[model samples]
Target: MNYIKNMEQEKALFLANEVTVQAGQIVSKTLAQNPHVSITLFAFGKGEEISSHDSSGDAMVLVLEGTGQFTVDGSEYVLGVGESLIMPAKKPHAVFAKEAFKMLLTVVFPSAT
Candidate 1:
């Protein structure tokens, strides 16, 4: 993602109902981005998952529909629609769709300078 350094910032409004969930697939849409943070919307089909990984920046997941199982550093947490969780920086994390689910992910990074 590139910074719109010299131009006026761009804004986009998204309706959660418009994000579609496909069978046996995971889809994502990046809504906003900048040097410091990124906001992404994701739809995961039943039994779909993201394998274990760690990020340098802190990340947050807000469940918009259905349920998800998040294993953060070996601790399991089940989050449903309207629930949220914060995964700390440098921690091992994995995501699994309890069924079909949708989430809004926000990752915040420290200043590069």
Candidate 2:
């Protein structure tokens, strides 16, 4: 039985080591990969920003829904909606929403071919 129901009419949305961004209407989704672990998704609108980054592996951030501010290495975290944070690899992270936000990010990879 092969059954896949509607991921926007599903035709290749399996993003391995993924990153998606849309500004103007504001949309952002980022996933790393898995079968070991790596996943990311972020959506923002009202003052969206995701700048400053550094990671070769080991990352986690989950705040699915409105309000956000997460910055590691410089230390700043003010999040809402089920908040979460864990970051270590290259160590430099950033995110800001502050009104419209949706996020779920997980990345864990060191060595596995």
Candidate 3:
């Protein structure tokens, strides 16, 4: 079974180029998704944002290009190219793009009882 989709197999590729930033919008490419984990790529236009929300999984983000602002539990952080951050599960978090940027987001969910 293919655990990953929307990408080529056995190829060398840059993650940042997987998605393109569109003016006034956010674009996402989900490479893998299951109950245990989710891997996604995102490109955000300048001033685009994702409103605050909580997740049931711990989310990690790696900046592939440009800059992004992350707010976790009311604290703010600005990340540039190659930077990464983790947002703990159950804590509120939000993401904003100060300029056009691309990122890889991996979320690991808790196991079911």
Candidate 4:
């Protein structure tokens, strides 16, 4: 199933169908990519995390399942299903999964703003 909600608009599919979280592993899928923006899906297993990093583009994470703890610019935010947060361009950020989780990530490059 194609889980990219906004991409491949010629057809329709649910976000839950795109990718799945697994034991001790992280999964991801790229729905679209361009100079202006990129759409991707990520599934993180419990206790998994992505190291802190800075992005040239503004990145938004939309939680689709379970829970995630986000550190953006030195502040921590805990999000559950349906929650979303934007990490601004050039800011330090990291993501940690307290539980198995899934999310849609949209990054908008500087040129697009």
Candidate 5:
């Protein structure tokens, strides 16, 4: 099945809105979902953060707006809009929004056991 659409209507699910996180508020949305991939959009309020955790599969984070820091295995890396980071399976990682920011998070999981 083809899910592609024209740019005009594509903005429907790609818009931003407020979301609440442990540290603060954020604006986010989910763009796509399939058996193999899931993509979500995030807009984090300043100081917002996600606690460190490990994933069962590989994941990718693409910064879409503002600034923030991502920690992988205890090492911190500054990130800005247009930047992307990859997290391998079982590695501990987290993200903190230094300022209100937007991002796209994509995760690819292993086939069902």
Candidate 6:
């Protein structure tokens, strides 16, 4: 089974170019998903946002291009290219596009034993 999908394997490529930002939309591409972990790529148009929510797993976001605003437990943070942040599990977090941006998100869940 392919744990990672929607992307080429063993080839040179830019993670930022894996997805695209639309005029007024949020686009996402899931690279891997399972009970243990999830990896995804996102492209957001200016003004786009993901409303506040809590997750069962810790989530990390890496900025690939442009700028993004992250709200974690009501605290706001701005991130630019090559920056990263981790949203602790069960913490209310949200993401917004300060400008058109791309990001890689990885979440790791506790073992489902």
TM per candidate: 0.85, 0.31, 0.98, 0.88, 0.76, 0.97
lDDT of 5 by residue, 52-112 (tens): 9998778898877678789988899888878888988799999888887778788897899
lDDT of 6 by residue, 1-113 (tens): 66899998889999999999997999999999999999999999999999999999999999999999999999999999999999999999999998999999999998887
Residue-pair clashes per candidate: 0, 2, 0, 0, 1, 0
Against the unseen true structure, what C-alpha lDDT does each candidate score? 0.86, 0.68, 0.97, 0.90, 0.75, 0.96
In terms of lDDT, the poorest run of 10 residues in model 3 is 1-10
Worst 10 residues of 1 by lDDT: 1-10
Ranking by lDDT: 3, 6, 4, 1, 5, 2
Residue-level lDDT for 25 in candidate 6: 98
Candidate 3 Cα outliers beyond 4 Å, as residue runs = none
Candidate 1 local distance difference test against the native: 0.86
* lDDT string, candidate 3, 12-90, tens digits: 9999989999999999999999999999999999999999999999999999999999999999999999999999999
Q: Which lDDT value does model 6 have at 14?
A: 97
**What is the TM-score of candidate 5?**
0.76
Say which prediction, candidate 1 or candidate 3, comes out ahead on lDDT. 3
* Candidates' RMSD to native: 4.1, 10.4, 0.5, 3.5, 4.2, 0.7
Clashing pairs in model 1, backbone N/Cα/C closer than 3 A: none
Worst 10 residues of 4 by lDDT: 1-10
Collision pairs in model 5? 19-26
Tens-digit lDDT track for model 2 on 1-113?
22222123435553321333445345544333544676656666777787889988878777766678888999998888787888788999888777776777778878776
lDDT computed for candidate 5 = 0.75
